[model samples]
Target chain A: MATLELRGVRKTYGTGEVVKGVDLSIKDREFVVFVGPSGCGKSTLLRMIAGLEEISAGELLIDGVRANEIPPDERELAMVFQSYALYPHMTVAGNMGFALKMAGKPKAEIAAKVAQAARILQLEALLDRRPKMLSGGQRQRVAIGRAIVRNPKCFLFDEPLSNLDAALRVQMRTEIAKLHQELEATMVYVTHDQVEAMTMADRIVVLNGGRVEQVGAPLELYRNPASKFVAGFIGSPRMNMLEVAVAGHDGAAVRLTLPGGESLAVPARDALVKTGARVTLGLRPESLNLADDGALRGKVEVVEHLGAEMLVHVRTPQDDLLIIKAPDEARIHPNQTVGIGINPARSCLFGEDGLALILRVDALA
Target chain B: MAGGTKVGGRREGRGWPLLSPAVIVLGIWSVVPLAMTLWYSTRYYNLLDPGRHFFVGLRNYDLLFSDPGSLTAIANSIILVASVLVISLIVGTALALLLNAEFPGRGAARLFAISPFFVMPPVAALIWKNLLLNPLNGLLGWMMGLFGLPVIPWFSTAPMVALIIIVSWEWIPFATLILLTALQSLDSSQIEAARMDGAGPLARLRYIILPHLGRPVAIVVMMETIFLLSIFAEILTTTSGGPGDATTTLTFLVYIRALLDFNVGGASAAGVLAIVLANIVGLFLMRSVARSLNR
Candidate 1:
């Protein structure tokens, strides 16, 4: 295993800079995942590390040696692409042993290694079948097997499970995580799906607009996102933001009036702003519930029941449509008035510039 | 489905009647001539002796097969087809590979490489014979004189070789275009995988690229075989059944037998035999080269 370091890595096309100065150090055997939205330089950084794309400026060190000038073949790293990219003409055994064969391994040795790998992957029965004859999951396994046979120092995965159906994606994602544990190899995976990043990564690197926003443990980012972008991008159904103005100010606590003119106490003590300064209160859907005698009031626009849970969409008097997760038995109907109590301890606050406000949360008494 | 099939069949049948005039004309022009040739191939009638003839039981074929002139023609035909196929596949595939690479002025280079295929065969041969490879007056001859070397006879002693060059000039362009198209469709990811697997350029070519090209290579062989076997104009213009009959291919041999030897029946027999041989070769190539069936 090798510790990979991308030192001041920058990528540009023509005159436009895409990945602007990204510096990341992936420890050996670390399952680091680069997570981002589309056009965010996650895949671009992965390609640079794989040597598929040229590093316009900066150094890549693998195991403490410069690897910028080296071609992908000599990098001692394997990649599993989104398309699988299996050699269609070859049998499963041949596909697995191709790298060994190319390395001039003896026929007997190649045979032995291929068999061992097949047994490991539980693909012994399919050794003679071509990739086209295999199912989507089988093909993906073969793609993994092809890389596994090489025994590279590291593995780079570019949205490897993106092509599978939703159910299969979860299954394959677990398999890949187990494979990483069994192999104990350094892997830097790239994906736009935060679920994949959260579930599979030892450390998740959230990138946006060609820059690293934050890198931390899955729960670390979930519990305390450093910025508004990271906070909104990490969770499903997304976080709701209501524009608010500070009505009254305390030392560490501020009384803010939400868009509906309903006041709530928020913890935000950085860059002391005058009264009436605008801000956005970040509230996750999961934190809102139909509590008795709640303060924020709105009319129920729609309620979406997903068998296990219900999603209540309430439009407040200020025209701020908010969605809150409710229990399956909760009664919510269209055009009916609804009030939601957001768990103040779990919500976040941000200034007008989208910088998350760190605070010791307390209510203004 | 039944109604759709019935309507399609009725429409096709109606279209057939519409095509009757062209079909009838082609039958009279082509089919009747082919039938006449078949009839003539089995007869003993010569053009000088009118229509009366006895049915020859493969006597003319035996005579033609046993003759030295016709044997020389058969040998030259085989040599010419072999030499043309080998040279074209090698040169065309090389040119195609070079064209497939990223280089400056690649579009111009490709157009230049396939230009000879569009040139008329007679003009190509004449250009080669007079100014390119001619012993006394060609470009090579002139270059040799610049080096103060004696001019060597290229067309006479090595007329078969010269014929090969001219025919390859015509066929290589077609082969190169087909190979280029095939090469372009090959996925770059597989190549990268092979490379990441530590496969050098040659190993990648041998294991991955060559196996991938099975279908296209088969196509090249089949197409080139059909076109090269019937080489006539190049042999006619350059060699003219040449000194010692070194370049008299099957088609040219058939031509001379009818025109010069005044043997219509024998020529028609040779023509029928050539066609049968081509069909047999076509079938053989098709049978051996299986489909790739790649996903």
Candidate 2:
């Protein structure tokens, strides 16, 4: 078992700092995914953990021991790169056993370990095939098999499924999640896809502009985001944001005025907001429903049918574009005037500083 | 005919008119000289006895096979090419690896390293014979004397070795440049993966870098073999076929027969022999290069 802890770990290239003072602790056998946009330093943080990039300052501890000076091989971590990076000249078996051979393992032992990893990765039939001879999916499996043969303390994956087709990406995602369970080793994964982060991670760390926006379970971040960035990033089709003015405080909720003079009272802590102050209203597409006599009035702009569910884009009277998810049976058409309904308890309110006001949810109670 | 073949044939038909000018020019340039050489090889022609020319089919071949000096020249040709090819490849690979790294003045250093290839062969051989390899006052001899080493006269004592050295010096830059370009194309991620796999510097070179360089090295070998087979200027300037026949390659032997002895028939026969030898070597090298490229 291995526990990775990063205390104020930073990476700077010349005058610019890419990973600016990150503090995190990954528990043993836990799968932590670092998810962010491009240039958010998620991959840079993974490289620093793998000892591929030098940590500019601060300390990295592996299993409670300071491992700042440790080399990558000595750190007992294996990485699966996005490009696979398999040795083109060597066969699958040779690629898997190279690390064991470098560590002076005997021939029989290396062969046995390579065989086991190939069996686990289902690469036994491809043992003699070079990397160029393998398909993209098979090459990805061999890259993972090479990492598995080493039996390192932790596994780091850097956007391993980005090069795959959509179907293959889903298939490999499940396979990687299964592999993590079977190995029960600490893993640090980096991806820009929020769905991959939500589905595969035990804990997800959302980064923006080289800093952690929030860190929590998938549903926890979904139900109660600590900032506007997390709320907008963690869902598909993106949460529809509208500017509003705080009307008043109502017990545990904040009453707000929408753009079209309609009001919304969202269930959140009222201490961080003042009346008549402008704040952003975040409504998930799934939380918004189409109704005949609903509160918010708008014209249906576009209707997208997905067999089971339909996403209807509406332009409100205030010219704000909003997406509402409806059932397939809802007869919605473009340019049709319709009223939209929002779930107050599921909605979120953000102050002017882009920080989400805390939500008082039933799950927390 | 198949539709695909018909389409391909039409495309080639259209391309031929555009390509015929170059093709015809090259055909005449190579075929005319070869025809003349073949025709002259079968005749008994001499500049000294110009009026006594006649058909002497295979007589020049018989005499060339019987001559001891001609056989020694053949052996020396093989020795010079083989030795120079080996030395240049090994030293070139080492220098390419060294120059691939980051260092101060690396741009300038690479410029200096590759500048030797720009020097004309005759000029380079002159510099080596006078300023470097000369026994009396050359830089190499003076350095050897400072280190308390015995200095032997290079051209007079070991002409074949001296010729090999000069040729290797000229060819090493070509090898290094080709291999360096191939080295740059190697994926940096592959090296990092090997590093993370616990391979040290030498292990990475043997297992990763060298295999990556295999195809390019084969190309270097094939190109160098073709050019090295006809090496003439360096030999003409440095040792001029040696104190005896020690450094006379087949190309030099041809020059000696036609110019020094004025026997056009003998020189043509030697030229034919050189062509046959070069073709054999080229065939093997091309096959090996194709194999490596396919790999």
Candidate 3:
């Protein structure tokens, strides 16, 4: 129901600028997740949007209204904190009904709203219990229920699921996605877990070192990253990077010599390719496969079986280790010589700068 | 079969021997004086008439209770403890909240705020008696004179008020120290969440900070009551229970019977009454504290 716009929003403390000039526009009902490594200011950016932190410079607009000076509660936005920050002295019903009480709502309205939220979060029987009596997952649900009772214009989550166990993290992840579908409210989520970002967000904003690296759909960022940082951050079993030199150019592609004396010609901008210039080649683990008479030859160092897929770590003759994702049933073992094939069209090339040189192309192109 | 059946109380009989040293020390320290006081309270023993020690079965208590001054002294004790407790708590909580805020020189300010507690009781009374409330050339008199107002004698005119002020000045620092420590442990995220929930400053204090300080405030009340109930030094130094029993409390009444009147049996009777009164107050206070803590 609200569109959030941050125009050159920067946060500076003393002399250190933590969130340096971020500009983003979140459309109404869009689930936007800010994904970054720790200390990349993703949480700080979310706090600024929540009005919990002051925007030192630049403007923040909510639904086309200037909201930088508005207080958090006045902004009509609810935030779920990582710590679950429930009032330990209050009962679950009391905790969920606090915001409504503060707004001077009638007692009956507050009770009804809290009841509805407790039902939505499946916490009917635990209303009288305090936070200390509940498990971690229940506390997390109470935090979300507290926010849900507010029925805010947007929802801001600051790594809410990061504190749960792995199994519970996945469960809460899907529950939050389902909640978003049911509410149709704008959500700005922040997490270091790219998997959560990939699964929950309609659009992902990748941040690194206090700057937005790229913003796009999940598959779009996967297929066409804007820079080396985004490619390394957005995927699990990170994209492999190798230092290569430009061997030649073929019309719209750049030819490069990879490790183990294998040559790869990846489609990149021809204008940025220079003969004999040093470049970086980005290859996802799935882009490399085991094949007979493959270009790149290596010795398998380790094979990891992951039920449906196995990751084979291959050591090239030059001591360069590369990982290849293969079917779990593939007969791969340690200390075996293998030839690894590369998919040229799916590969990425970077010049001296870490900016990706590949243009967005069809997956089968 | 006996060992198996005796499952709970003193099953091994080994704990008492290990715990005897402290028990013996405490028995000699407390039980002996209490027993002697009880014995003396029932006997007609006077230091002036040493040869006339005889059993008098509640006669001393009856005489002491019949005196109207004894009633006044009891009321004075209650008034002093109650007023000091109220003043110290309200002022101490305000000071604690102020000191908890982040400001330059806060460490130095906190050190100064709790410095009055470090001064011994008699010394604090002496300072207040001579320098501050002294009416004749004291700092307060000088300040009043500067405003072209007549100096009002504090000890002679309002002796009980003077005593309460000096005692509260000493105990407020203690309340602040405990309450500030409690305030410091309050989670910052809780405050931020309340702010996000639209609680203003006063609401935050009412709903969050005060409830967070409930246990510490109870401790302060119990401890201050224990000490303030037996307040003697400030009364002795400034008012000496003076201006015709205006500031006389139960403890001073006991002192008067024993030392000033040479009536050992009567003083012992008053002392026993004081102990009973303290236990009664302590029983109620402990029950309330236990209930709050359980909640």
Candidate 4:
């Protein structure tokens, strides 16, 4: 296993730069997931690290050796493409053992390695079948097995599970996580699905607009998003954000106002508040509740029952909609005026520039 | 509504009236002549003299079997088709691979490559014969004089070689065009995946591209075989089976017997033999290739 590093790596196609000045270090045996929205340069960065794309500027290092000039074959990295680009004519055994055969490995060793990988992937019965005979999930296994036979310095997965069905994707996700642990090889995976990154990554690098927005564990990003974008991206059903203005401040508690004569005295940031500063208040769906002693009242627009919980899309007097997960099967009617409980402690406040306003523990206590 | 209906399921198998236009055209254009040929194959019938009739049935067929000229014609036909098809396939597939590669002015190069197929066969034959391989005045002689190399009598020393060259030149563009289109449509991602699997250039070609080209190569071979088997005009214009029957093929032999020798019975017999030979070859080939394609 080798430590891979990218120092201000850049890539441009014709005119517009696809991967712009990226710097990252992947430690040995570390599983790093590059998570982003589409066109955020995650796959391009992974390809650059694998030496598939030419680095326009800066350098790439593998095990302290500058590898910018090395070709992909010489780089000793295997990539599982999003399409599971298996050789159509080759059998499962042929697809997996092709690399070793290319490398001039001994016949016995090639056979042994193929058998081992097939056993790991439960592909013993499928060894003689061609790719056309295999299902999508089986083809994905073959694609992964093809990568496994190389035993390269690192394994790069470009959304390897995207083509499988939902159930297969989850199964293969777990299989890949187990494979990483079993191999203990350096891996860099790129996916637009943050759930994949959140579930599988040791450290998820959240990227947006070709820049790394935040790098942390899944729960760390969920609990303390560095910016509003990360806040919206990291959580399921997405965090709700609404524009708000500072009404006034009262020591640790501050008064905020919405449109149409709406006001509430919620908690304040440790930093000094400006009266005219434009900010967005973010609330997770599970953060609010409906109770008799509630602080904010809104008309229930849509009520969705999920057996275990209910989601009420509540419309405030200012016409801002908030989705709250009522922890029980609350049979609420739509168009009925309902009051919502508030927890300022669970809500996040962002400045006009979308930077997180770090909160203190003493104020919540 | 009653007239517009398709009638009964019992009338399903009796749909020939619905197909009568096509059947009538085919009968007029194809079946009638084939039946005439079959009838003529069994008689001494001539279009020039309808009354000079005799039932000299097996005589013409026996004469064809015994005649060394007719046998040599059949052999030459087989040799020409086999040689030309192999040559065109290799040359065409190589051209396709080269055209598939990314290069400067590749579009113009491809246009130049496929232009020869569009050249009318007779015109193409004339160009190769009178303008290209002509012993004295052609470009080959001119180039030979410029390079101080001995000018070769292309038609005399190697008659079949001349025919092979002419056929390949005419049909190579077509074969190359087919193979090139197939190569262009190949998914680049699959090849990239192979490359990442540590396959070098030769391995990629042998294991990946060749397998992908299998069905297309089969198609080129099948289509080219049918055309090459009856290559008549090129030989007719160039050698005309001259210099003691050195390049006489089956079609040329039939033409000589019917048009030159005026033996319509012998020619009809030879034509039947030619059809049988072609069917044997085609059936032998279709068995293998149809495994990869629809009949």
The residue-by-residue lDDT of candidate 2 on B1-295, one tens digit each, is 6999999999999999999999999989999999989888999999999899999999999998899988888888889888988898899999999999999999999999899999999999999999999999899999999999999799999988888999999999999999889888988888888889999899999999999999989989999988998999999998889788888999999999999999999999999998888998999999999999999
Instruction: Give chain A TM for each model in order.
Output: 0.94, 0.97, 0.97, 0.92
Question: What value does the lDDT take at residue B114 in candidate 1?
Answer: 87
| DockQ for each model | 0.66, 0.75, 0.71, 0.69
lDDT by residue (tens digit), candidate 1, A77-179: 9999888888878899999999998788999999998887787778999999989899998899888888888889999999999889999999999999999
CAPRI docking class of candidate 3: medium
lDDT of 4 at A118: 91
Error of 1 at A31 (Å): 1.0
As for lDDT, the candidate ahead, 2 or 4, is 2
Instruction: Report RMSD for candidate 3.
Output: 2.2
Calculate the i-RMS of every candidate, to one decimal place. Answer: 1.1, 0.7, 0.7, 1.0
Give all TM-scores, in the order shown.
Answer: 0.91, 0.96, 0.95, 0.93
Poorest lDDT segment (10 consecutive residues) of candidate 2 chain B: B69-78
For model 3, how does the per-residue alpha-carbon lDDT over A111-215 read when each residue is reduced to its tens digit?
A: 999999999899999999999999999999999999999999999999999889999999999999999999899999999999999999999999998899999
Write down the DockQ of candidate 3.
Answer: 0.71
RMSD of 4: 3.7
By DockQ: ranked, best first: 2, 3, 4, 1
Docking class of 4: medium
Per-model lDDT: 0.85, 0.91, 0.92, 0.85
- In every candidate, how many clashes are there? 0, 0, 0, 0
lDDT of 3 at B281: 93
lDDT of 3 at A215: 94
